[model samples]
Target chain A: MSLAKRIIPCLDCDNGRVVKGVKFVDIRDAGDPVEISKRYCEQGADEITFLDITASTEDRGTTIHTVEAIASEVFIPLTVGGGIRTLQDIRDMLNAGADKVGINTSAVLNPEFVREAAERFGAQCIVVAIDAKCVSGPGEPKRWEIFTHGGRKPTGLDAIAWAQKMTAYGAGEILLTSMDRDGTKNGFDLDLTRAISDAVAVPVIASGGVGNLQHLVDGIKIGKADAVLAASIFHFGEYTIPQAKAFMREQGIEVR
Target chain B: MTHLAVIDYGMGNLHSVAKALEHVARRADLTFKISVSADPKVLQAADRLVFPGVGAMRDCMGEIRRLGIDEILREQIQHKPVLAICVGMQALMERSEENGGVECIGLFRGEVRRFAAGQHDAKGELLKVPHMGWSEVKQRAHPLWRGIPEGSRFYFVHSYYVQPHDSAEVVGVTDYPAPFCAALARDNIFAVQFHPEKSQDSGLQLLQNFLTWSGHA
Candidate 1:
């Protein structure tokens, strides 16, 4: 109730410029992160989330220049994630004007980091992102399984239960992403999103599989998500924020 | 120029609101500029001020105090058009139950309380918490909603709603359990529980009215 219906456009960056494609390929130079962020701000993006897709175990520093550049140019909130392992990384991101920090691989490997981040910088500043794929089965773990390292490795953990643990560890929000639906433009994994939302008390942002405005409405109305996150649809100029909200309004979903 | 100053103090959703205002101004053939900043000088030069929010009311008020915009808002509301949307509107109330308790801008004598619908209304009872969907705003006479139709739907994503001390200030009402105030206005001050920016035509027209009234058209 305290949170608004967020329309977040994620910028997946390798170095500085935005990139696209499944598993990060085609290597399209969308635009400068700062410039693209400014455009999104003008186009009505509630928040900007930058996933340093390249910042992995090998890479040490995040695209600090990109973060600083975009942070200096916009006024809305920004959340920086990817390769965030240590407290120093979180500190650097916050000092760079990031309102929130998202944890993926590290949090999955060491769940205590979530609790540490929450304790140091209020739980509101910490976001735990989960990339999950539905496992095919019945009594033998028929639930969604966690995928880490940008969907390169499967953690073999039930996503529903992991999300509950993350919340318990003091994650302010959950960025629940569907690896199966990601980059497919099919639709959000409503079943996956709802399962996670129903399990947590914090806000849940539904990511992946947003092809049209109806996808967003479905995410909010049926999925019961606090926000919806998409990439290519907003990046390729498929839908403007106003247009999406207008559509949601017609569909009876609370937006903005 | 109809310059709109979108107050910013580490709060999200200002850009989205500004974009909607900018789009409305363009459609209305009005020359308007929307700037997002916490600098006091920008506020001083603004013709209109819009406070947009998407977070806790307590935290928002804390940021407003941190930025020292509370007094500026009071002074500006007396002279120029001020629109408070979503949590922005909630911040205009006397208090809220967001984090146990918090005091807000006393622009209107009201308290924001969470929706208490235990059971689903469709299931022969009140609906659950976190009222999330489009609901009609029973429109009344207000400059901000001049051309918006009666029972026009606007996007609403909030669990708490305002109950104004003076019923006259309630310009729009919508039903959930009982009738609730969806929009409020008194003089230059305007507030809405629903997000007009996200309401499509009805929302666009409302923004157009604000732009036009601010002398942008």
Candidate 2:
């Protein structure tokens, strides 16, 4: 049998509670991160990702406690992203039972931090998160630039080139998020996903703009992403993970 | 109570492994006391052992040697049951190509090899290295495979795979463009490249079987 395409449910967490932001605005509370994660695990989610959106230092402590509580009970791969700036931050999350940590702003700021984190903690646990926004117009040559501060600022770095560089610097996986489509639910940026997926040798997880199970399939079939990450589709109980997997399986995409 | 020690060399997280064992042990018929330790005394006193690891081969071997777990593993494997996971399975080999070729504990006659770049599957699709995902594991006859079906999927995350010199030692295999040893077994030792702790239900079943295993084929 071949390796199954992964279905990961993204939980945007704030101070131990799950939240969702539409296009990085209009935040809404969901539930406890730990409780929601357990439900996702039970629903046959291949992995669970917690994006800690809490900006305050005091509230960050709650994220770790939330991770610890989930790790103690949930028997699945857990990835924590957002505000992972240092090796100590990565260590604290891992020690709190996170299987992987996503490095976005830190990697773009220093670039060397990716190499250092990989050297210290192995490439398997280091995931480079790239937030890309389409800079070129529809008729133009389809160019995308890396963005920081939750897709608010542009770094002028090419998304394809940055992905290749991160993998070369020892990133085991790439979390590709389409800033333009993030909460739009129009489906993933297929062209952008395919570009980054083909550019890097490591696995690429396609994030943003997933409204239905078909979007998940398109991410793997058309975008060629090794995995698909979604927030609202699963969070709002619009569809269960099993249903998504079944639909993907019917579409002939192997899923566990 | 049966004492189980999960050997920790500070290579990777042992929290999931310990927690998984505790979860399975709760409903088990036998009482279990699970501990995560690097101390020789604690390892030597355990009735069963779990060797879990992640990271570079050189660093893993370095910590294994520095902490004297190599000797403890060699001693404990003689009689008690032992289960190795991920890089821990790789460490049982004679050597590895990782970190520019490093020597391992030599419990099994094998060598670790990296997944060659530009490898393709049957569909002509380029297979990614590190093989990070859930893949179906084809099992052979073994106690740890009791509740797990013949081709159940398990979670795996690694760049290199073990190649035991003797085919008789391989208890499970998975295809990542090609068939590779996913699980190894002998009289008192059972090792796997996949993480049973993070593999959900099927993985939990394997660990539950491991807890009740008698160290026999």
lDDT of 1 by residue, B1-217 (tens): 7788888765545444666677677767887788888888898888888887765666678888989988888888877888888778888889987768889988899898877635344424235345544566787777677777777766666767898899999988987666888988888878888777656567778877877675211
List clashing residue pairs in candidate 1: A252-B134, B119-B126
Candidates' chain B TM-scores in the order shown:
0.94, 0.98
For model 2, the stretches where C-alpha displacement exceeds 4 angstroms are A55-62
Model 2 chain A: ten consecutive residues of lowest lDDT: A54-63
lDDT of 1: 0.78
Residue A140 lDDT in candidate 1: 71
Off by over 4 Å in 1: A1-128, A134-143, A153-157, A165-175, A180-194, A197-256, B10-12, B18-23, B26-45, B116-136, B149-159, B174-180, B197-202, B214-217
User: All models: lDDT?
Assistant: 0.78, 0.90
Two-chain complex of model 2, DockQ on C-alpha atoms against the true structure: 0.76
Query: What 10-residue stretch in candidate 2 chain B is worst by lDDT?
Result: B27-36
DockQ, each predicted model: 0.06, 0.76
Per-residue alpha-carbon lDDT of candidate 2 for residues A36-67, written as tens digits (9 for 90 to 100)? 89999999999998887654222343367778
